[model samples]
Target: MSGVTLSNVVKKYGETQVIHGVELTVDPGEFCVFVGPSGCGKSTLLRMIAGLEETSAGEIRIGTRDVTRLDPAQRGVAMVFQTYALYPHMSVAENMGFGLKMNGHPKAEIREKVAKASSILHLDDYLHRKPKALSGGQRQRVAIGRAIVRGPEVFLFDEPLSNLDAELRVEMRVEIARLHREIGATMIYVTHDQVEAMTLADKIVVLRGGRVEQVGAPLDLYREPDNLFVAGFIGSPAMNLLPAHPTEGGIHVPALGPEVIACRPPGHVSELVAGFRPQSLRIGAGDTHSVEMTEALGGVSFIHCARDGQPKLVIETKGNHVERPGTDISVHVDPDEMFLFDKLTGHRLR
Candidate 1:
């Protein structure tokens, strides 16, 4: 019942509009992530939902209650920012219980809530340590613990993992996932990292230019992107987009030579863009295409190559490959894996 709903939400700053009529819904206990490149307004939308930012138009509802004009404290939501924002002068336990203490809760009650949150975050041993004494990951956990003590109906995370090191980011991703499962609170997270969005979200809202590009489950968006933008943006290393033209049999990709990458396209589209993921492409031994580079990341290697000096196409290869730079290779285009889009419009051609 604590799910969030937004109806044609809009935000403007002195006539400069940002969020434009965004309609979204997050089910209770669901983990929703807002993901996009920078300046896409993902963080602005999260702030609007948290009641920290005012809506220029439309309404926001949380658990059947309209909170469009309510104060942030009035909305049953807790937010954890990218920064820990913990008190360096106080112990971990003290920092966690500060909000409750301000709300005039009894000392015994505050201690109990802090203890429960600490146990959940595995901060029991470090409860007496100050913020300066903890690692980045531990400090982030303490920030999360502070939110947990409030028992908010919804949790807002604005790129909470961005501040951590690569290893710590991975570790915290697991921890956040576990926290969602354990607490089962409705959570909305915003991040620019597609990997984090794919791993943490039950549903992802992909935003662009202050508008929603697409919203769906991670694999759903991956397998069937609505446009060239979604296809190119959602995956790691990104999907390969090459200029092509529609022909009688299929789309002719100059990069792959005369043989067209087979795909059924709606009529009226002549020029098109052919899309393929790195994993979907296979390279054969040939000199027609030269290997530009190979990224060896254990067990799998991403082979980057170009056809006739065109845009580089990435092909994923499993196991050990002896292919070195300047090695000539040929691509085996899987017709079934091909995605076609309108060249000019960038819209997917069904």
Candidate 2:
């Protein structure tokens, strides 16, 4: 397995720059995910690494070899795209071994490699079937198997599971995770879904507007975000950010109650933003807020509360309890669970 390194990597289209100077390293056998909102340049960066897009400035190295100017074929990287991109007329075995065949490998070698890949992806029984005969998930496995036969130093997946249904997507996530463990190859995956990034990545690169906001382990980014962007983007329902004012000993949060939350703020800061995850809050007694909606999903429920001018707050609770719309309620927040940020710059106040 070989690691991938990027130093001051940049991309541009004529006079407009899409990918800023990005510096990242994917350790050998690491599953690194690039996650962000749409049009955030996550796909652009992945294409640059795969040699599909030219780097305007900087260097890209796979292990020790600088692949900045190398062709995709020469970079020793295989990419699996959102679409299966399979030949309808060709059998699964043929699709898997096509790259090697075109490169002039012997028939025996091609068949051997295809068989091995098929076994690994559990596509051995479907080798004789054409792309049209297989299901979406099986076709995706064929696409993945094609990459495996090449034995590339790095595997690049650009939203490979986007085309699948919800059930298939979950199943394929497990398959991809298992494949990574069994092959132990350096893989770079790009997705806009934070849930996918959180579950699949060993390291996640969060990007926005062509710039990296943070890079760290999944839980690390979730528990300790660097700024407001990360704090809001990394979570499912997102962290609740309420407008606040700095007080003598703590911060005054109007959304929670009239009382000041017991948390220290920087002396220089005046305006503050307080963050609270839905799970950190609970429904208490009193009618300070009104329930806007309630989403009861089997074992858990999310209650959306609203006030006159305050930001909406989502309170996550256990069980199938549902609150009626316009029902008066009070939200209780623990001072220790609050995350303070500077309202002006959107930076965490720590």
Candidate 3:
């Protein structure tokens, strides 16, 4: 029962259905992440599981109990929100132990739990400090420590690290990853950030417009997406999609050139979109393109290129230099690295 389950879950506000039938299960002690762009219903799903919002239909179960209609406190889950939601007036220790104190636990026990969580989160040095007195990352740790002190069966994080600066966000991401391992508590995290999902999730659920796109391991979604949405949404810099016409044995990408490259769709490929990761788009001798612009990251580089009269294409590189824009050049893509989707369904051709 330490795990969570949603059976055909649906949510609505008046006439508008925000969540479609969503059937989901989180294995005990599993770290599951729900990721999507803004307004994709990822947060709504998390809140529903936290018992904050009512389900218009379907059932929600937590730890073997049907908690669909239960109060938030009765769900045996603790949530860390994007806002941190800390008590400005209370010190770290008091803030963390407040729930236990309100629930009428013994003073000594509440203090003990707060101390243990603070120790775990390394909040001991700031136990007496208030929220405003802490740095962004420190306050976030306090918020997580508060959730930890609850000792709930499941932890729900709703973009808890979104407010942090980029550098701190990565730091907190690693901390949360380590925390999940240390506690071994089942976690359901929601984020618009793909990096977080990729790094933290034992399983990642890619949601779109209230429906579940696909759920799988981080690399599984990256390497093999079931639909165009999942394919484009799961990776960094996003996957590059180049429309093509289906040919006898392969696809003819007129945008790239006149050649009809011979290749087979991934297993089960049918009506869907064609796709390729930027890293799969290669340029060098034998393969060429007109470089529109070049961006260099410390560890990698990207060339924004296109054919003589084609739309811009993105290619990843670390050492290659790009030519200027408006120049005609040849280019090639790896058949194994390429992706194809049904023209009509937007589902992966394979």
Candidate 4:
């Protein structure tokens, strides 16, 4: 097992720079996930570490060895991509062992490695079948098994479950989690899905526009985002960011009536934004806001509401407490559970 490190990493395509100075370290045997919106450079950063993409500047280290200039094959890493990328004609056993075969390993050794990978991935039953005969999840497992046979120091997964169906994605998530526990290798996974990052990572690196927004444990980022972007992007349904202005005693919110909220930051400030999670909102009767939509997901429901001059807000509530669209409702905001950010700079206010 080996840890991965990037020091002041940068990437550029001609004069257009896609990745900013990035500093990160993945501890040995830790599962690290890179998550962001599309075009955020998460995939680019992953590729750079895998040696599939060149680094314009900075050093990448796999263990103690600097791999910044090494060839992809020379790096002690395995990559599982979004696509299965399996050869249709090859059986599972052949596909898993093909890398070893090409590397000039003995036939017996190749078979043993293939068998071990197959067992680890629960692919022993499908070894005789070709990729065409397998389901999407099964084929992905075969792709993973192929990586396993290489005995890589670090595993790189670039949205490996994006191709699977909803149910299959869930199953694959469990499978991958178990595989991580069983192997205990350093793994770096990149995905745009916050849910996946939340569930699968020992540390989550949140990125935005080629810059890393925050890096920490999932709940740490969720509960204590460094800025407004991290606050909004880390959670499902997102944190509700409402426009407001600082008052003498509290922050004044038009929608919440003449009564001021006593949640202003220390010192004098002008414009501010109030943030709170949807789950933190408690529904009540009022005429200030109106429900726009309701999404019931079996046990929980999300109430999408619209305030007169503010952005739309989603409130998470029990499924049994579903409110109809156009219903007049009010939400209570707890100052202790709320977050405050500077409206101008988008920086969080402590």
Question: Which residue pairs collide in model 2, if any?
Answer: none
Selected candidate, larger TM-score, 2 vs 3: 2
- Candidate 1 lDDT over 26-50, as tens digits, reads 9999999999999999999999999
Q: Is candidate 2 or 3 superior in lDDT? A: 2
RMSD of 3: 2.2
User: Residue 206, candidate 4: how far off, in angstroms?
Assistant: 0.9
Instruction: Please provide, for model 3 over 233-325, each residue's C-alpha lDDT reduced to its tens digit, 9 standing for 90 to 100.
Output: 888888887777767787777666677778863445444456778888766564446667777775788878776676667778876455565
lDDT of each: 0.92, 0.94, 0.86, 0.91
Q: Worst lDDT window (10 residues) for model 1?
A: 257-266
Model 4: CA > 4 A from native: none
- The best-first sequence of candidates by TM-score reads 2, 1, 4, 3
Against the hidden true structure, what lDDT does model 3 obtain? 0.86
Model 1, runs deviating above 4 Å: none
Q: Taking the tens digit of each residue's C-alpha lDDT, what string does model 2 give over 194-234?
A: 99999999999999999999999999999999899999999
Q: Candidate 2 at 10: error in angstroms? A: 1.0
